[model samples]
Target: MAISLHWLIALLIFAGWGLGFYMHDLPLSPAKLRYYSWHKWMGVTTFILAFLRAGWLATHPAPRLPRVIPPWQTRTARITHFVLYLLMFLIPLSGWLMSSAKGVPTVYFGVLPLPDLIGKDKALGDFLVQVHKWLAFGLAALVGLHIAAAMKHHFMDRDGLMGRMVPFLKSPRL
Candidate 1:
């Protein structure tokens, strides 16, 4: 369940990132509007999934770190995981807040309307746009690090750490 949610959220994050970047430079047009709506909806979906994932993680605590992993690396891993969760929640929220401040309604999948976080305030909206942008880049960086760590565990350490999330993969022998 966790692995499934992880992949789903990852896909949405990357896709939304791409769409957000692409739509930013496009001139006002139907395509741009469509893409923006899709991106916003994806962000909403990501927010929901992240919440569910966090709850699931809370109930099902993460497995013990391999004894072979040094104490420092273990600590770093814990910190990184916590930061990832923080960003996962913050990224979408910042976007929603920015949209709300810009006087835009967030309609999930063009069906469900969400209330605005704040009334129109161009100044606050601009600030939130920057916040959302930076948070997304931070998320991208952390996700890269997370993937690199998983690969290192799977290919170099062969400690079965990656196998915890990817049960189909056979843990390589050291």
Candidate 2:
């Protein structure tokens, strides 16, 4: 369940990020509106998956770092993970709030409408646009860091840390 949620959320985040960058500057039209709707749908789905992932983590817990890893790397990994989880929630909420402020409603998969987080305010909406954008970029960077750390463990350390989540990649030397 944890691994499944991890991959699913990862896919959604990347797709949403790609669509966000693609749709940001297009002239207002039906295609742009459709893309925005799709992006919001992905964000909402990611938000829901993040909650499930957190709940799963609370019950199951992440594996401890390999003892051979330096304490600094361990601390950095933990801090980065916490912040990644935080951005998983914050980015989606910011987008939802921004939509509300812009007088646009988020309809989950074009069906159920989520309640607005705040009353309409153009200035606040403008502010939240930046907030969401920067938060997503932060997420992107951390994701890169996460992947790099995994690769370092798998290839250099041969510690099987990557196998903690992805069993097929467990190093034979472990």
In terms of lDDT, which candidate is strongest? 2
TM-score of 2: 0.96
Q: List per-candidate RMSD values in Å.
A: 1.1, 1.4
Write model 1 residue lDDT over 1-174, tens digit each, in one string: 899999999999999999999999999999998998999999989989999999999999877997899999999899999999899889999999999999988988889999998899999999999999999999999999999999998999888889888889988874
**Local distance difference test, each candidate:** 0.92, 0.94
Residue-wise lDDT of candidate 2 within 1-174, one digit each (tens)? 999999999999999999999999999999999999999999999999999999999999987876888999999999999999999999999999999999999999999999999999999999999999999999999999999998988888888788877867758573
- Cα distance off (Å), candidate 2, residue 70: 1.3
- Candidate 2 local lDDT, residue 24: 99
Residue 105's lDDT within candidate 1 is 89
| Clashing pairs for predicted structure model 2, backbone only | none
